[model samples]
Structures are given as structure tokens and as C-alpha cells.
Target: MAPQDRLTATFTRADRVAPTPLRSIPQLRVDGLSVSYGPHEVVTNVSFELGRGESLALIGESGSGKSTIARAVLRLLPSGGHATGRVAFDGQEVLGISERGFRPLRGRAIGFVPQDPANSLNPVRTIGAQAQEAAALLDEPDKAIRKQLILETFAQVGLDTPLRVYDSYPHQLSGGMLQRVLIGLAILPRPALLVADEPTSALDVTIQKRILDLLTRLQHDLKISLLLITHDLAIAAERADSLVVLKDGVIQEAGRTASVFSSPASAYAKKLRADVPALNPDRYAALRDTGFRSLKTGQAPKIEVSAVTKTFTVDGKALTAVDDLSFSVPAGTTHALVGESGSGKTTTVRLLLGLEGPDTGSISVAGEQITGRSPEALRTVWRHLQLVYQNPFTSLDPTWTIERLVREPLDRFKIGTRKERDERVREALANVGLGEHLLSRKPGALSGGQRQRVAIARSLVLKPDVIVLDEPTSALDVSVQAGIVEVLLSLQATLGLTYVFVSHDLALVRQLAHTVSVMHRGRIVEHGTVADIFDNPQQPYTRSLLASIPSGGNDVAHMRTRAFG
Candidate 1:
């Protein structure tokens, strides 16, 4: 069937299935929601109705103004962004409401959960204080009542040891834990509406599922309306009741999740879904039988770590980050170090790159034990190993241009002269699907995906024997991720380079890695072929990880329940 006809059919099915809109009442009404930032109109004529306890997903690529429309609903536009549309919540005109009146409606009647928890939370204040503050905002004047409310709220979000977590600061908790705290605070007031913008993007697959399940439970039990803002259509399809596809501030398609996913109505929607990268069966078949076996002949050890371990002392208490972890990457092969946060994945990579010293174990590169080496000794080995970090924003120097950023690594290694380095930088940029025009722009000027490509370009300039990709695609969109993966594959083929990929994204890992290593806490609980790990994982932890991956094949329909008024 034609893409447009299919999308229309899907949307038509949703319209037929959904109950007719009540003339008297709608939980939230956004009519001709237009938003502009100075000279540019970010979102134009956006309209949607969210009934009581209904979920509406706002999905699009980066810079598509999905977030803008979401923020406009709360009148929380970024500085200089103006809105010219009627946003009514619970029959009240929200955009027309006074600041004093809006204050009560914001946290009590409607709650917001931003994308990044680090930015949402206060680093210095304890989580208890934050939770208490959230409860206090509800006008529960009594001290005892507030304390009881906060503790109960924390418990509702599945936070284990509420007392301990309350006492701990934001920095002390992991991303998943912090997200739970955010959920606790948002739901403390029992708000009618909850707007979550990419709430689980920073989390691992397991944590993402836990958060999704928690949100689903909350929506049903509390009868809360949800407006989920995300770039992931898979997440939207798996969680939302209604899906609204947006591109360049325009609505491309809107319908029930199942209808839109099974058969989209718009060309844009079809294109977007087609762009999502699924696991390649042929690649999986090739590596499914290759368990934790030794490398084949003519394979050079581009990156080798022999029994690496790391320990940290916090408040005089010792904690082991990694325990005698050993792995090797042969030339032209990709070795993935799969683990959750704090599993010592980053620490292991740091040691291999001579960025830090391991407490116990030696690291060998090209047959040389480079552990405990001097700065001079490390410099020679550093040229052979390059790293592409997870957060491209923090990795690239904001002050430098893309050209300078890509050229810095070459100059550091003294690979070539100024003109030669420039040529190599240009070549690297092209390899990553960027051009010389982007070279003049600073890291801040580029989009998230573009910034990451710049980081990749910089790493590729060295043409190292091994590249350590630390969650390279975690922060990017699926289409951008697919493009980046292609670039990495091409580089591997052309340069005969090896890769050590560290990521919490199981789907991405399964697509790229030859062998999978499932880590829990600080150790690998399972190491084997991708098929062995996915189809029949031995360890309970491994099985849990496998089960947690959000797939369309999973029984999500049963989990999706709309709350009634």
C-alpha cells in the first residue's frame, strides 16, 4: 500500500476506536499553538486534545520543535520564545493565567519531568530536602504531614531504603535512581497531568523499562494524563496510547499508537519509521556461534587488557569498580564491553588508554605492557588508541572550531604538518558525512548528532589501531545512530581497525558486537555469543537485561491502560 494511504488508514482506525470528544469538557486543549523565537517560528498551528488520564506522545527528530510545543503547554518557553495559542488545562486558559495563578497550577495541577536529571536536581541539597520541598509546594502547612507525605511519595516510586536515599545528595544516586526521585516529586501532588520529556533516554535498557512500567502503573492507579515528549518512536509506540508525529514544527501524523506503528498515515511518518535501525539477522547469524572463543589466526592484538581492577575510597569506605576484568580486541574486530553505569566500563577504558592506572593488572597494546607507564611511555602508545566518549558536548572544547577540534589530535600525536593535518581533518569530516563548511562552526553551533560526528571525525584522524567507543550513539537519534554505525563499519573495513564499544544500549550492542559481555555491579556475569545472550541467557542478571529491552514484539498492549476521570 502507498505510505500516505497506509498512514491515513491507521489514523482513521484510531479515530474510529477512540471515544468522541466531549463538547463540555477536555482535560487539556491546545488549539493553534504557535511559538516563535525572535524571527523564527519554531512551532506553527499545533493542536491536540488530551483527555483525562490519556497519553499523547510528541515525537520527532532533534530541532523538530517537539520540545517547544511540550514546553508551551506549561508556558515554560525558553527565554525570548513567545507563544500565541490557547493552552487550556482542566477548562482553565493556562497561557492567559496570571503568574500567581500559574504557580499553583504548575506543580500541583500539572507536573513536569525534564530530559536531564542532573539539570533538574540541586547537586548540593539532599534528595530528602527536594522531596520535602515538592510536598511542601502543595500547601500542606503542617511539618509532620509534609514529612509523612514525602516519605510515602518516595516509597510510591519504588525507591528502596527511602531514609538513606533521602539523606543522599543527587550526585550520590545513579541516573535511574535520580529519575525515580524525579517521578516521586512529580507525583507527590497527585497532579492530573504529567509531562515527561525523554525521561529515560539517559538510562540503560533495563532502567528504561523499569521507568516505563512505573509510569504506566502511575498513570492507571492515579488516573493521571501523560504528554510524553521523545525522539524515539519505538518508545512512543510501546508506551503511548496516541502518537503525534511532528517534523520542522509541523504535525505529520496523529493517531493511536498501534495504528501509526503498524501502518503510518503520512509519508514523513513512514520515512521516520523506516529510518529506525533494526537488528540485522545475517550479522547475528554470523556471530551467534562464536562464543567466548579465542581470536582467529593473523589477528593482531590491537587492544589487550590483562586482569585490570580498580578500587575507590569514599568516606573511608572502599568500593571495587572493576574486578580482574580481562578482554582483548583483535585488529578489524569489534569487542564490546557491555555494562550498566558504575559497572567499571568507563574505568576499564581509561586504564587501557593510559588515562589512569589500574590498581591491579597489566594492559598490553601491540605486544607491549603499557601499565604503570610514564607520561613519555604512554604518549607513544596513545597514538595507537583513540576514544570517542558518550557525551560529545562535554568532550569537545566549546571554544574551538570543528576544524581545530578535529586537528587537535593529529597535532598532539604530531602525525603531520599543518596543511597535511587540515587535509586529514577534511577527509575525516567527509567520512562522517560532514563537510568543510561545518569545520568553521563551534561545537555549540552544531546539533547533538553533528557534535558527535565531529568527535568521531577527530578520533578517525589518528587512524588508530583500536578505537574505544564509549556509548557513541546513546545521545543521538536512531537515524543518526544508524548513519554513525555505518561510518564506523566503513572505517573498520578500510583501516583494518579494531573497536572496543562500551554501551548500555543492548540493541545497538547486538547490532555491532561479535561477542557480548553482560556486567552487573562491577563484574561480567555472562560472556558468550549474542544469540546465546539474547535467546537463552544463563545468568539471571543476563536474562533480566534481555527481558528489559523495549521491543515491538513484546506484549506492551496489555501494559498500556488509559486512566478514566
Candidate 2:
């Protein structure tokens, strides 16, 4: 039979035998699993189980061995990596099997969806070719049947144009679409268990919601067991039936998702809960209400954007990137521009920072007209207006030391003599809570959060009046993001720095932004205070974005209640 029709038969079977009761044989189980690499133990005594058609989350910080355990489960450990203990799928031990014997278990009985789709898919091959190649590994051998299955899976994964997506290369699709394609490829063979590792961490909140909802539906309708590995506590809390909190290669806590969050036993688990923005929704919002760096209303606004329109030539056609955008950021406050990937947030920030002149309208920072300025003139504007890029890993020169990286702006502007510039560099480092010892180290030596902090310190070195932060924390994990946010808040309160923040995460924006503009299709759909925008949004697009926030842990919570009853 064709794979598409085979998938339909599998669904019919699932409908007849779904939601295996509590105490049944688990679909996946790990008992006392310990993994070591070159005599260095990374995962120790980790134990967890996923019930049939259920999801279990493994959550922790980086180097916590979450992925290590996952790799061990799939027998994909890297060089010198050794795993001991039990990994059972469908009550059969998988670890004892040899490589030749294990080959059949993969792609037929088990499927894996890794974190990065860009690396997972072949860049040079058409999506259809790649899907067909993957399909050939299973029982389906007919080319036409494989093509039909691939198209059916693509459409089912919410791709509106399956044929177009099938014909296009991986680069032609957006990150979210690529992720959907990857998921579809994994499930095309009707695997019994799906392992998703950091599946939506890099996506926009709206897209993340869709991907997660799709996963939930796959679990419910297809009755596939799921093992979710993520550092995001909010997603783990809402999506998993059970949670295993890992730290330093050991299981810190494990229990029903709702039970653990309600009264976490481990300090690590509690700290993770405290740091997640969705769980503690109001932590940073109080700062705006407490008169912290209250806006200097009487003073000239820090950023004045008047009817700005930015256009670009894409494929020999005029593309309006930002259309008639107008917003004022009061001095010493944060104004966030939020939208989907193509919604003009980046273009608006580019125009505001004078990186690009507007096609129409004017932009002024601190009352200085920035529109239509020569590059030499904009150099002066750049001194008072700096930018913090999205990914610090790429932004900071890997070859430069942290001190030199932070000191570049000051050196460029010739702000001070050798001694004074050195002193300013120290001050900037101190501002972000980085010690002097890290000065000699390059960005490669630092963690993601530390690198971002160094990035922030660099922007602050010039003591710019306005800073454009473009998705500064999106690249970091949740706790690291929280740490970076704390530093930014402290810096803003102490220095009264004006900020233009850009992000696709409404949850993060709610905590950080004073005023927010919801951008869509290169236009401002709604603009208002964070409170007004969230509580009483006026636009349908704005409401949809707000509604996309992940709160699906309730499904597993409900299952817990049902099982206990």
C-alpha cells in the first residue's frame, strides 16, 4: 500500500486503541542511564519513562546532559562517548543491540527531530528529493507512492503549498516552515515515538505555538509517544505529562508536570520556574509601574520617527519593508517593535539606528536629523546611537579579546586617552557584571549569556544615548535570557539609557517594553503601552499573537488528574 494510505490505516488503528491507561508498559524508559565521554562522566543515574501516546520532558541548562541522554537513546553518541544502563522501547532493551541489529529500529520504529533544521536537511537538494530519499529507507519502495506520501505529510504539517515546498530547496523556506518539513519527514513512516530536541527554541513565539500545537496533535491523533528535550521551563511545564529536571549530569527532580511546578522540591527546579517569563508573568512588568526610570516626558523624546517608510529592491521589484511607521520613545524608556519575521521590525530598527536612510519621512535621535546624512555625518550619529545585534556568537569577533571587543567603540570615537579609555572599558565590563579576569579571554571562551553581556558592554562603552537591541536574548536559553534581562534593566535604571528593542516574543516584550508597536505586513497594526496592548488589544493580528502564547501543559495536567482519579 502507498505510505499515505498506510498512514491513514495507522490513524484508524490509533483511534481504536488510544490513550493507554496509567501503569501500562511505557513506550520508552530509561533506568540508571549514565553516559561518559573520555572518562568524563556527563549523564549519571538518569531515569525516566514515557507512557504510550504520552510526552515526557527533560529540562535543564546547557551541559546538563539532556541531549547526551537523548543521543544515547538513539545510539548516536559521538566519539569516545559511552553509555551504560537501560534504554527500553516497547518493553525491549535497545542498548544491548549491535549496530547492525539497531539499524532497523531507526526510522522504522523510532524518529528523531533535532533542534536545527538548517543542519538537518540537505541544503543542495530539493525538498522532494530529500523526502523521497528518506522514504526509501523504510518499507515504501515505489517512487510515485513515496511522492504521494511526501506531499500528503507536507500538507498535513500545515504547509499551504506542498508541491511548492516539495520543489523548493531548504533555503527557500523560512525557519518555521523548514521545521514543519523536518517534523513531517520524521513522521512520514509512522514511527511509534518522536524525540524532539529544542524543536522551537529559535522560532518566533507565534510559530513556536504552531509547531508545538502540531506536536500535541500528532501525539493525540496519531498516538505517538514523545520525548521532548528543551531548556524552556514554560514549554516543559505546559506540554509534558511528566518532567525530569536535570543538572550537572544528574536528575534533580522528576514528577508530574503540574505537581513539580506547584511545589518544586529541588532548588534548581524552583529557580528554573522563577526564571521562566511565562510562569512569572509579572516580574519585570512591575518596574514600569514603580516609577523606575520614569519617562522624561517634558524633555525631547530620545527617538523621534515621523512617518518613516523604508523600501528595498527584491528581485528587481520595490518591496516596502517599513511603511508609514511613526513612533516616539520617551527618553530613558524602552519602546519595542514586535512582529513576525518579515513584519518590518528589523527594517524599522535599521532606519532608527541610521544604518539605512528612510525612503520617506524623517528620523531624529536626540533632536538631530538623521535622514539623508552622509556616512561621515552619520559617524557622529553612531556615537550617540549604537546597536546590540541578535546573536552575540557572530557579532563579537572570535579573534578579539573581550577587553578589545568592548574597547573598540571607545577607540573608534577617540573618547579618551589610553588610561581613560582603559578605565572606561573596565567600567563597561563592570556594568554588565563581567569581571576583569575575563578581559584577556576571547568570545569563544565565554558562555552564550556572558557573550551577550560582553556584547551589551560594547554598546555601552561609548555611552550612547540610544541603544537599538535587536532580539538580544532570543539566542540564549530561558535562564540565561533572564540573567541578560536583569543586567539590561539594572543598566537602564542606573544610566537612564533609552532603548529601541525588537523581538518576536510578546512574552518577553511584555516584561521589558514600556510602549510597543505591533507590526504586520510592513505596517504598525497596533501601538500602545504594554498593558493596553496586552490587556485590550485592538487588532485581530495583535490578539492572535497574544493568544499564541504556550499554555498547553494543561493537557498533561489533565491526564495526571484523570489517571489519579
Candidate 3:
């Protein structure tokens, strides 16, 4: 079946499940919940109640202790972690219970879906085997029946080729596919409460919508309470009934999702709302209005790809990674390439960066051809082009200090002396708003936002004309992403830099890119200005992508009326 057909089939299954009536009694309740890891108290006096068939979202940035609270409920905290609280599920106390006591209630009564599917599943095990284990936890004694039920659940979750997915390992599937598998496993037991922690953070917008929809359908059909932990306020507004805002292990505010979004009671909540790029209409207008001034001056385009085509062999079959792809980025402007995982966005980047040779077509950087350049010849071109990768944690060397990491580019180019290199590193750090104190610290010691800043600094140290940002802010929180976006805008305006931003985040793309290209299956489906693509998308795929975005307009209006009236 085709991708669209698979998606349609999935939607059909999701829509078939009718909403179950909610029960009156509280399904899960936590009172005076306080969790600590050794001497450090992460969660302090957090309290919330989740009624049957209700959805409650815990929203906060990293280190806010939202996830810690989720783990505390399951009694799945690390060895050093301790919990001081009353956790009741269906009128039964869960905290302070023995492992054996909690065993029966875990997968049988409550289900868990973690953030990263990659980290949750055993890479060595087959998907069917892992799912079968989950089925066993539900006390399904008969082997033949359990296997049949597992496959049925997989089909219900919209796995097109259930047998293929069942036999495949974790590493063989995409993030969206893996997430669906995990969701399928979680719902197989038909638990009363489903805890989804950042379940869609790593997925594309369209895939995220499908997953959320599936979860909603499951909740309605199974009459299960949902405890969703996420950093995205938009998702919370769309999918959750109530919102619990946490900061530094403390509850900042608690209320209906719409009410909180419309008029946040806490400063943190308001800040988060302001940070969401989609909510702020005028945030990027000024930046965009700055316009492509360099384009009018008759300057050549900074980066150009003319009919570039790249193919790779996978499973003894030829896969066209990038098929006759063509796009250009003018100087001092941002051009975004938006697509799903296998849409050839990364392949195009690889082609542009000279990491891989295109089978056909030409790529140029600053008017210099780079498609067939030798390594020695391309060394000069490397100075004018740099890439800031997706994950800062994994990209930076753990053993190296911040100074060494940032200076490695300059050292490789043999651009400066020790003093000059130190000055350059300091200057780069300052540009990204990092202080000298972090110079000696390694990437591990820095926070997510700080490490990303370091990565940007490393890329800027070369003072490249074009910086290819590959999902640079996708893994970050909204506020952190806003900060990074602001930094990039500032850098572009001041230094007159060009950016080729590759991302799945349409919201961020709207705020950052002047021009947009929507790729689907190795081809550019749509290309135009940001307004044209977002406000008036011409292609069906682009329109579908836009529709997939969770719009909280209805919730906002409902909140407004409820709060004021």
C-alpha cells in the first residue's frame, strides 16, 4: 500500500472507536507528592487528580521534574531516588508498596509510553517478541491466543505490514513506526491509565498528529485516563483536558488547558505561551521585513543546487535519496527545507556539503562548484561552509573541553595562532551569549540550550558564508528554541550570513525562513515564500502538512469565554 493509503487506513481504524462514558470516581490521585534523588529534592508538594477517561498534561521545561513525577507514580524511579507521597490508583495506595505488590498493577492496571522509542525498546529483540512480552503481563495465558491478539492490536494501531514489522528489529524502523509499535504494545493490555511522556517530540508534525489521534481514540474506547507529559503548550491545549504547569519540581499552576493557555496564572506559563512561535503572529515579521537586501544588489546566490540527484543501495535495492532536486539560497537570507523523515532533506544537505557525490547535477557554494571537488580542493570550500547538527549532546566530543571543541575547526583550517584562536573562540561564544566560565567545561556539563549554543559557536568560528542547520532546535524546548532562533536572526542581520535550515517543524520554519521548500519522497512538492507556503499552500501535501498542525484556536476561544464570563 502507498503512504497515503496507509495513513487513511490508520485514520479509519482510529475513527471507528467511539468515546466511552467517563466514570465519576478518580482513577488516579496523587497528594503531597515529593520525590528526591539522594540529597536533591526534585519534586516538592506536587498534587493532581486524574479522573477516569480524563486527560491531564504536565507541562514544563527540562529539569522541571515533570518526568520525575511520572516515574514516581509508577514507582520506577532510579535506585537513589526516593518518593514521599500518597499515590492512589482506583482507591489503592501505590507508593511504599513492594515490587511484588506493584507488579500485578503495573502493566495490568497502568500503561507507559516513554519519550524516545529508540531508548525504550530493546534493539536486539524483534518487535513481535517485545510486544508478546507486554501481552503476557496482562495475564493472557494461552500462547496462540496471545499471538493472535498481538497481531490484531498491531493492525488496529495501523501497522500496514504487521508481519513485517513484527519480524523486524527496532533499528530497522522509522521513529514514527517505532512509536506506533510502542503504542500498540502499551494498549494491548487495555490498561486503565496511559502515561505518555513526550510521546511525539521526535516525530514529524503529521506523524505526531496521527499518534495523538490514535491515543485519543484509545482513551475514548478503553475509557482510560491519560497522563500526558510534554513541553509543548500547543499539544497540551489540543489533546489534554487539564493542564499542570511545573517548574523546579513545583506546581506553578493547575487548571483547564484552554483557561491556562488563554490567561496563564503563572509567569512561567505566560513565558511559555509567548515563546511558542505559532502563537506570536508578529514575532518574525520584523525579521522578514528586513528583506533579502543582498539579492537586490546583483550578488550571486550563496548556495545553489542544480538538478542534484543522489541514490543509495539499501537491502540490495536502489533507493533514490534525492531525485533531481534543485534549490537556491540567496545571500543574507534563510531558506528552509521542510519534509518528513524520508523526504530527502538530509540527503540534499549531504549533497550540498560534499559529504556525498550526486549521481547527476551540480552544487555550488559561493559561486564555486563543489559537486566533484577533491578533498584537498574542497578543503578551501569547507572554510566557507559549515554544518550545525541536530543533537548537540552527541555531536560534541565528551572528552574535549568547550574551548577545544570550538577551536577544532579553526585548528583544522590552520587559520590562526594560539592567541588568535583563543580570541576567536571567545568572540564566537559571546556571539551566542555564552560566558567565559563555560570555556573550560565540557559538553556534558552544559545544559541542552547551552550545548546548542556551543554548537552554533563552533559553526560560526569558521565565519562561514553558509550554515546548514539540520534540525538545530527541534530537540529543544520552545523557549530555548526561541532564544536560538533569535540568536540566529541576530547573527544573520549583523554578519550577513546565509542559512539552509533543514527541519520538520513548520512553526519554527515559518518564523525563521524567508523562503520555504516542502519536500516529499525525494522531490520538491512546493516552493515559495513563507506566507505563500503557510497561508496559501498550493500542493496537496503542503496543505496536509499544514492541517496536521495542532491549532488551539477553539480552545483559546473557549478559555476566553470561560475565564471572562
TM-score of each: 0.90, 0.95, 0.93
Tens-place lDDT per residue, model 1, 1-565, is 5433332342232321224555346778899998999989989898988877788899988888888987888778879999998998877788977778888778877898889999999999998877777877656566665676676667888988777888999998899989999998998777788999999998988899899889988888877789999887778887888888999999999888889888998998887776554423343333322322324553666666777788989889999988878766766777788777777888778887888888988889877777878989888777877889998999999999999999988887788788898899999999888988998899999988889889988888887777889999988987778678777876665667778889988877777766667777778788866667877888888787777776654366665643332
lDDT of 2 by residue, 1-565 (tens): 6566675764344532335563387888899999998879999988888887788899999989998998999999998999999998888799989989888778767889999999999999999988987787655556887788789989988999999999999999999999999999988877888999999989988999889878877777667889999998888877788899999899999998878878899999999888887766688765554323465244458889899888899999999999999988888788999999999998887787777888899999998999989889999989989899999999999999998999998888888799999999999999999999999999999999999999999999999888999999988878899988878877777788888999998888887888899999899999988889999999999999988776534764564445433
What does candidate 3's lDDT look like per residue over 296-334, in tens digits? 464568888999889899999999999888888888889
**Candidate 1 residue pairs in backbone clash:** 7-264, 7-265, 8-265
TM-score-superior candidate, 1 or 2: 2
Off by over 4 Å in 2: 1-3, 6-23, 285-293, 296-298, 551-565
Model 3 alpha-carbon drift over 4 Å, by segment: 1-23, 295-299, 555-565
- What's the count of clashing pairs in each model shown? 3, 1, 0
Q: After superposition, how far is residue 90 of candidate 1 from its true place, in Å?
A: 2.3
Error of 2 at 337 (Å): 0.6
Worst 10 residues of 2 by lDDT: 10-19
Clashing pairs in 2: 238-553
Displacement of the residue 345 alpha carbon in candidate 1, Å? 0.7
- Report the error of model 1 at residue 146, Å: 0.6
Error of 2 at 289 (Å): 5.1
